[model samples]
Target: MKIYLLYTGGTVGSVGKPLGPLAGPRFVDAFRANVETIITSQLPGTTINYDYFTPTLDSTNMQPADWVRIAQKVLSNYKKNDAFLVLHGTDTMAWTSSALSFLLPGISKPLFVTGSQLPLFFEQDESYTLLFNTDALRNVLGAIQFMTFAIPEVALYFADTLYRGNRVIKSNAREFTAFSSSNYPALGRYGVLPVLNERLVRPAPSTNALNNHIQKVAADLNIIMENINRSSVIQFLLFPAYYDRTSGDSLIVSMLTQLSRVNPPLRGIVFESFGEGNIPDFASMQALLMDLSTSGIILVDCTQVYAGDVNYGAYATGAWLKGAGVISGYDMTPVAALAKLVIQLARDPSSPKDEIQKAMSTDLAGEMVIL
Candidate 1:
């Protein structure tokens, strides 16, 4: 099996920054050598090649431009590889994976984006080349086995669980098991072999001589990215009652007013409401949301709750938001909502506002639990 590795840099590509106890060898070099050694000795006949991006990025500093660059890289190699693997950083790995879920459409191959909590070189076991870091090695190896299958999704393989890229969030920063799919079950888990949950995977895209689905989607993204203004999308959170008591109307109004002043105007905003998408039914708050709708701002209502769907119409507090033309965010994580908005806005399709609303509620990238 052939796999193309895109090392976009993360802790996986780093060997600690220069400091008293941190300085060391570049991780890309060490990881490359170990990977080659493992393939030659342990998995004969399997080929894995990689490209380390220049000036590798730390996920903490990642951006939309970086996301687009990765999309371009994947498309560049799509025609030549059986599957693709991305070595990304845990900090923004979920976002990158989610973003790619939107960008790469109609794919019929496995694309696994994974990284480790500890650097791959930290494994206590010293005799192994690739198994030096148990968790890191397990994920990479599991990803390898997945590459040999027909799983057609952008999955984040972390710890021992495989989550749909858009459905996972970095739940812990200090643990080896750093991510979790709170609203959804994992696509599968890694064990003696990669046990896939067949029901969780999206159907493979159909292709015939008259159509090369992957190529068409890539071209569509290229055209869309060219027109997308990544900076124009905004995200705002509704604070607790104290915020409203302190000056809620002015606070929310000022935020949107400033957004309106932006050169190209605000394209969309993901409004993080309270539990179950609830927000004060204050007249001023209602007015602001109505204003946003009239201003053609795409407002998507999401919950700040950790693991449940947002149903604005279920309660009276949320009813006005639904009436004000805000789209319910369902069970999407904030990170997924933002990244999905960026991708959807980039496309700049006709009837932009309606399109954004539809895309948010619709499972374009399986980023949310709509039911």
Candidate 2:
């Protein structure tokens, strides 16, 4: 079996020496020599191919477009390899992995993504040296088939636990245990024997080749957090437990009012609602939110809760909000919803205001729950 190692710049591939507080290590010829030596010595008979990105990048510099590139690279190589391994930077690994799972729909091979906390060039550890070897990976291939890879979807493997990418959030900046999937458990543990957790993995879809089955169409999603331009599109980040507070109410109004004043009028608003879709029933809050919806801005009732389905209009308060023009957000996360809204808004600024309502409810990137 041939394993292709696609290296996109990250700490794992970075080589630089510190110069006081601002200095970074440079990737010298010795760095490559060390890596090659370790691979050659540890995996005696295995064949491994290495490719570097045009220009290495720090994990902080990662974007969705970068993910598109990585996915394309894998798709391009689907015919020649039995399985693939990606050495990625941990910073945005979860986001990239999640995007890949969506972009590459029917992946059938072991597309394992791993990287060390310390660069192989800078560190000296048995784990990094041993794990980087083809032998370390070859031993696990007998049991890692298409079905096993599907479980936990595209996962982030670090510090022992393997977590589903979409569910994982970056919780640390310096530690090896940087990624965590709080809503879900590790898909499987990696130790003496990698235990397969069938329940967590999704069954493979019907497809001839994993590469050709991907949805090549990429979404033009935007993640608006601080940049609320004078554009007609606006979304409010609402936490359920705090939606009742005067502060939350004010934020909602400020965002709505600001958008309404923009040229061509605002398109919609995504209310990042709290747990299982509950919101404050205060008349002031209801009127303010409903007024924007009635005025043609889409009001998406997204849940702030990390897990579970959002039951919009389930309670009297929820029903009142829904009746007043709020659409159930279902189970979309704030980041996903915001991105979806940006995509929709960009496609058609004058989109039948109902588009936001619809997109937020749909399961794009497996980021939302249908039920």
Candidate 3:
């Protein structure tokens, strides 16, 4: 089987004491000399092809344009390769994976994203050597094995489990199991053998359907690229604050109102609100939010709690947000919500506020539960 490996630098490809990413060509060479040897010996007849971004970026520096570039490369090479593996930074891997799910809907082949907390190789006497004790090699190998299953979704493989990409979040910074999918079950698990939860995997689309999906994606991408520069979407985390006793002005209100007045005009916001999507009912705060909604800003309310769905009407505090035009982001991680909003706004800058709200509430790529 043939697999296309796209190494867009991350912790897995870094070296040196300070942990800097290796150049694309250098990492590719080291990968072929080391990891490639082991894979070929164990699984003969596996052909691995390589590609990478120029001047590799840390995951922290990744942007929407970078995501567009990655999607374009994968779609252009979709027909020739049997499956695709992306070596990405654990920091924003979920966002990239989630964006890919929307960008390449109904993908028929396996596409896995993974990275490690530790580098795959260590520098010894000015030379790079394999670091067998690290999780980097293990995760990559696991992804390689899982690809043979032909799982037809964009998934993230880390540690010993494979999860639906959009459902995952970075829950741990120091451990090898850095990702967790609180609302969705594992797509597969790696133990003595790689076992798949076949029922959860999406069925591969028919040839005609797949081709049509690709055409739509290509067309949408052009629109996204054209509007991406003007797309201004953000995530706002709520906290306890009150209207100033003396000034009668709320910090929350001031900040959001100022944001709304910026050049691009803050097209959308994902409010990381309190339990069950509740927010403080400060009058000025409520008024500013209502004004923003009336002015065509797409507002989404997502829960700050880690593992629960957003229920806007369950409590009185949350009801006002819904009444003011905020849509519920049911069980979607903040990362998924932010990426989805950005993609939707970029795909159609002039989309009506209600239309954008509907797109956020709907489960386009298994990112959220509608119920």
Best by TM-score: 3
Using Cα atoms with residue i matched to residue i, what is each candidate's TM-score against the true structure?
Answer: 0.88, 0.66, 0.96
How far is 255's C-alpha from truth in model 1 (Å)?
Answer: 3.3
- The sequence of per-residue lDDT tens digits that candidate 1 reaches over residues 20-43 is 111223444566667666654655
- The residue-level lDDT of candidate 2 at 276 comes to 64
- Arranged by TM-score with the best first, the candidates are 3, 1, 2
Which one is best on lDDT? 3
List RMSD in Å for every model shown: 3.8, 6.7, 1.7
Name model 2 segments beyond 4 Å from true: 15-32, 36-46, 115-118, 123-153, 213-236, 239-249, 259-271, 279-302, 305-309, 313-321, 324-369
Please give the lDDT score at residue 125 for candidate 1: 34
Tens-digit lDDT track of model 3 for 231-325: 58888999887676446598788788878877766898899999999987767777778888898888898887888988866888888887787
The 10 consecutive residues of candidate 3 with the worst lDDT sum are: 206-215
Q: Which stretches of candidate 1 lie over 4 Å from their true place?
A: 18-28, 40-42, 122-134, 207-211, 241-249
Q: CA lDDT, every prediction?
A: 0.75, 0.57, 0.86
